[model samples]
Target chain A: MDSLDDYQIPYGLMAEFDTPADAMHAAEQVRDAGFTRWDVHTPYPVHGMDDAMGLGNSKVGWFTFCCGLCGFFGGMLMIWYMNAYDYGIPVGGKPNFSPFASFPVAYEMTILSGAFGSLFGMLFLNKLPRLHHPLLKNMRFADVTHDKFFVVIEADDPKYEEEETRALLKKAGSKHIELVNE
Target chain B: MANHSVPSSVKIAPPPEELERPALVENNRSLGWISDTVAGVIENKTPGWWKLTFGISLLVSLGLPIGLVYLISTGVGVWGLNHPVAWGWAIVNFVWWIGIGHAGTLISAILFLLRQKWRTSINRASEAMTIFAVMCAGIFPAVHVGRIWFDWWLFPLPNANSIWPQFRSPLLWDVFAVSTYFTVSVLFWYMGLIPDLATMRDRFRKVAGKVVKPAAKMRNKLAQFLYGLFSLGWTGSNRHWRNYEKAYLLLAGLSTPLVLSVHSIVSFDFAVSQLPGWHTTIFPPYFVAGAVFGGFAMVMTLMIPLVSLYKGLDEIVTIRHLEVMSKVILVTGSIVGYAYGMEFFIAYYGGNPYELYAFKNRAFGDMNWSYWWMIGCNVLAPQFFWFKWCRTTPWFIWVVCGFVNIGMWMERFVIVVTSLHNDFMPGNWGYYSPSWVDMITYFGTFGFFMTLFLLFCRFLPLIAISEVKGVTPQADPHHPLGGAKH
Candidate 1:
């Protein structure tokens, strides 16, 4: 492979903020600036930051809802298929397909599938378990888990301009700015 | 702390003392401070007491598998189970352990959905407690199935014999209920751990800079890699948090029903039966209440010592948290007491001689000592918490909670044994007493539970670092709310 330094690969520029407010303000400015591929990172969830980033409500609930419905019916069907349709049992002289008797298992399965759906949905939507990100290459970036908050404007954003983005971040109260590598 | 100032047009801030909510975590520590406190417990040297406790627990934990192996080799006859009392201490301990597991879900999921911020400080440890308790609970049923090797018969797989689990049996419902409870609990606990693992990963990297030993440096690297892998490369990105929060809420929503249903189904194991004492409709709610009561007692039992053992946890797991938990114990304990009273009242009111005799037998028969102990421990012990001193004093509350824990176990004993030992036919009636194998297996489960918990305390973040930080006013930016512009 060619020498790494010779290649032109602009990953992004990261700006650090001392507080969540500065990060939130910077995020709003970045959002209004029409950057679609940018994000804010903080040690914990910053209330109202979702609005600051102009992100929509998460679709994870819908996934869980659908899975729960499927599980409810699926569990009931399985019980009926096994007990009533497939092999008829005359134990207790009660009907094999009683919904009252089957409700507990059905309820349990609904929760099981719903929980799995939500967890997988969240991971899927967030594209998690990536195990690597360009931002992680910078040691100081790890501070996002501690005290620091950051806003990263990806170079892939169509509106990105090296000088202008740097100036924009500085104006938004960023304490430290770095040119992150790909 | 982040900005608390608000705009003039909104409601004026009240005096600080009159604030709507008391601080969940005291001392007004920073986000980094909270992370450092939790991570330091893991990174620091193992305390001498921790070593001593873990050593004893480890030796005890070995007995669990030993007892199981012995039971399997010698057959279920090794247990005290026989004749009228076929479900001995195994089922009693199973129901007890499963019941004890409920408080974790109640704290993590139900409280999370309810927005009880105080839960964050203790939820991580309690959730670990839940997982371990369930593991102990699982061993009972696995061994209870006479031919242990053929336990797969519980599962509905395509088989040559073509036999299926009895769908109408509450025991079958338990197979599904318990497995799902374990799976969802683990997922919820792991999901909550992701951000904290990232925190741990970062802390390990920082420690690597100061370590002089090459071996220590390599260990740090390994630890960092493990944390990073489990954290799923989390960066606290807003998009990720948005989705993570939603998914967490949905899981909490799903688990609430599960917590209620699991114990109800457990109660159904008896309530569905034809026996007079076991056939009561009140068993479902009564069992759930007793479970929560026992669970909170166990949490208190675990938390009191743990909060004192680790430095800085006093501020995080404040005395007020214990007070609130005590209040819950009091409430649930009363419900259990009321259920006990109603069982007698209804038996008399209905004029059913069999039901009346069963109730009378419980309070005045051969096992009356066990029944009285259950009432004393579960019902009377928690009544002390009504006094603020008893609730506020850690040692006093701990001792009381210990009784509550013992009482809950005995309550299970009374429910399982008392109900089964006496039936309609006086000829078939018999007394049940635990054998050595039964006693050893029960004690071994404690070793198993404590061993897992001690490991959790030493390795994982005992407090949910990210969740605790999220609750503090500092994380808000505009803390009291109106100052920061959107």
Candidate 2:
């Protein structure tokens, strides 16, 4: 399958830090050192890590904005085609292409597109709905929702080497490191 | 001494400690504040009007099961219906309720964005109002179809039946817009609530005393499950807060246009049709404006009575908060009034005999009295807001807010019944008054709305305790507002 999902990161490497700052620092070094297939797992979401991890500004909003524009035009087109061209019911001399009556439909479509655009775009972009993850296989992943921080280096990263990754993570201030495989 | 260490003007002692809680506890929901006033209000005795209101709503909502059974058994004919107005009360109330949801989002989101300090007191109740009202709003469209038993048909894709619901239908559009609004609003409301609920859970644990059956495992389990599901595992760490805050900001930004879109889509129900008064470009904005106007009024009406009964009014909800809401009421009320004039001007300018006559008949015909009453309540009553005396006085604001709700409801009444009463054909023209079912159902809806809200107030953390606590200088209040300095 030629898909982002097919670009699977099968094995995981874990690093633990007590303070968020140190964890975020390690995440940045891992990313800046040119490891693309990676993720930062924390007890909770960390600030500035997206920048640290070399993630671009999310294209989800662009998807929403574009889809919403599409919706606006689609609404106008549907209404125009259905009411004016197809049915042709003329009550007043108002244009068959009435922008006024079209506004409500356009408004709804904009909302519809923006909402679904963000949601579906997020799921698709993240390659979600896989039902399970390699992270879930790690019992230590449980504490990621609580009082700890960890960063995982995926085997799929081009720079990934078990001994090298461990050494790199230890130098970046990780208090503990573990190897995880699925 | 703790309060006095600060400069005199810098530290205002919030009203007496007893006046600071956000809403009245069940035992303390009565009126009065004598030396024994706390005793009086807190004696497991409720007030007359409130008891009456709560009782009526309880009965009506209890009948909701009955209404559902009737609807399921007898089909949608459980209410009056015919060809021209196949929708009737359900659709009317759907839009009304959804419109009702806006004020809370406005208070929580818009005020949050603008950095209004006063919103803390009222936003909790306002958000509760939003959730309950949206619950009420969501009901109508589900049952409006003849066989509501198969209501899942209001979906986006092709189903097992191999017939995808028409994307072209306005009702389908409403389904998508409204469901999305409700989903996001629920997400927004719940995500904001978890920390407060955790606070409650913690407080309740200590107050439960030693050896209390392992702390009601089932109850705790449900709260934990709900909390876990929604919060996505929040720990309130500064690092977590950074992302949580960003996610919230992103959501608020998303919800802003959503609020506008949902109501306008609802208005399309009428505007798309060519039924004289029904067909117009003005309906969308007018409906959205009127929704916000009524929504704010309802928000004030509930909050004033609530914060007065709760222990912490001055700090959590200051008089300044009331003043800010009064401004909102003023702004939205003006937009509604403007919409009214636009309708008239457009009608006159167009000079289509039927459209012009419909406007004339509403203003000067049999229903002229209701039209003027609406103008008086929604428009004229809010004008009193121009005076600070009126805005600051809780009793005064309550009275005016009451008028705004009545006026907005009447506006819908005038639109629906009057327009339908006299159509193009003089022979078919007739007045339609709601029968007992109509009036009862309307009352039931109020009952339904209040019942859910009262339960929320009593059970849930009606005030956003953590959010409010987050803003207090005690919680980083000394920081410049919205952390602009950061």
Candidate 3:
């Protein structure tokens, strides 16, 4: 156990709230407290929490839109090269480079890539596929999937003071508070 | 304290009618209650009926590999395919199975995007069905190539032959369309399952009591580990929920178009061809409507049995869900019927002798029996849903859906066989029929689909626990008026 001392670090302090309103109120205070490294968790998406947390509009839509555009052009270019430029053979006596003929494949590709981009972007933004989270070590954290709400302020935040932060969370009406160890 | 009680912005009180109707999930269930109920179903012992169904399905599914071995060794000639009628039961089955997959995506992705709250209980099962049905659909086109080994030729991979897939061809487009549809559906389904799987993980952990013996404790830890692994360490953190919700909404938007495009591209397999009965503009919308119709029938067929078999599930998967799905069947079935009628009218009104003969041949031709079967099952059968009794009764709906499944299959038969059996060149035209290999392979797909479904029911949370809980008023912590009191 002594040998493990070097590996251990202070993960964060987590505070639990009973309702979305309680969590949102706490989140607003924490945001005002100017803690950049923090988050709130709830069972389902609570409306107005993002605004309370001061999160910017998600960049995922842009990623999907760009990927979809690439798919469209990439599909167009592939068809143009294969049908018109490569070994051009007219089957129904139609034009080889007919845009009408290429629309279905291109449209399908656009959607395919757009969907892939959205899913991957979401995963990346959330930093998922991280199978071990410090938060998971706490059994009560599971309630975030069911009923309870939680907020965590990371120790790495510049203004994080252990006693002061605990006092702040207590004032915010957090019923149960625990230190998460890494 | 005032801020903590109820935010001024929250709209917890729903309309007056919401009180008149039964809850989408009955008994005024709480979030904890919903999770426990769904997870309880999975942890319980395999029921005798489930085991029996699985046993029968597994036994019948063996026919698939056996049929395939015979098909590969003996070659495509074992099927009833001839020169003129080159596309036989294989293509028809492909279209039918693929069309059946559409309703799952429609319910999960399309209805979800439309924010239909009632979809929450059923979406999980239907999405799983979409993936399984696509697996069944992908088999026909692969084996239909005769040389099963060279099916990779459908892919546009660079090879020694240096031949890329023809981008202009509808068959090649199907390769892209179906593959993309499969990939996206799986991702969407799995993404939705993560939160629910986490709920299951926690539930199992809770049951693995603290003071239990070492052996029991180890079992609990193992279960927790497995669930945790599948959940990707989901702690339901607020940050994760935000991104998850955004991803879900975006995926829903993408899939709505995908469901429509997939069947339309499948339709192109017929519409792009020069065949008089086949090449028509109506095929795309017509095919899409028919696919949705058939897909809903399959959903109803699967769901009716599931809710009845599981004790607590009937409360979650309420009667309203079935009634709503039945109404969808009625609407889409009518569209399919109208398309069939329009095909005839256009065939006669178009003034082309080839088209005229094709429509005439469909009604009074060699395969006229199939045409009437299609009409009787697809058109006349579902019109019974117009009555409240037929729509609400489970057995009645199931029987009607059975007709729908049969009718849809016959519709495909009428569409494919009728046009091909008599073409412009009378000498080349020939009748199509399924040999033993064709019939066995087709029957085996049902077994394959059911086997996967039973396994899914046994292992995974069949209904989404988290999603169902999310829809309940209890999940809304701040909305005391809307949600159940703590």
Q: Which is the winner by DockQ between candidate 1 and candidate 3? A: 1
Report the first chain's TM-score for all candidates: 0.96, 0.86, 0.94
lDDT string, candidate 1, B1-486, tens digits: 013334566775445776558777787787788988889899899999999999999898888888888998989898888889998899999999999999999999999988888999999999999999999999999989889888888888867788777888889999999999999999999999999999998888766779889998898989999998999999999999999999988999999989999999899999988888899999999999999999999999999999998899999999999999999999999999999999999999989899898889999999999899999999899999899999899999999999998899999899888888898889989999888888888999999899899999988999999999888877877764322444
- Interface residue Cα RMSD of candidate 2 after superposition: 10.5
Q: How big is the RMSD of model 3?
A: 3.0
- Cα DockQ of the candidate 1 complex: 0.61
Best by the lDDT measure: 1
* Residue pair clashes in candidate 1: none
What tens digits encode model 3's per-residue C-alpha lDDT throughout B1-486? 234346657656655874555668888876667776777778787799998999999988888998899999989999989878888899899999999999999999889888898998999899889999999999999999999999887875667866667778898888889998998899899999888888778777666666378976886788788888888877777677787888888889999999999999999899989998899999999999999999999999999999998988999988888999999999999999999889989988889999999999988988899999999999999999999999899999999999999999999988888888898989877888789999999989999999999988887889887777777765554456232243
Stretches of candidate 1 off by over 4 Å are A1-3, B1-16, B480-486
Q: Write the per-residue lDDT of candidate 2 for residues B23-52, one digit (tens) a residue.
A: 312222211111122222222335566577
Kindly provide the TM-score of model 3 when superposed on the true structure, using C-alpha atoms.
Answer: 0.93
Q: What is candidate 3's CA lDDT for residue B434?
A: 86
Q: Which segments of model 2 are wrong by more than 4 Å?
A: A1-182, B1-56, B67-87, B157-161, B204-232, B477-486
Give the best candidate by TM-score: 1
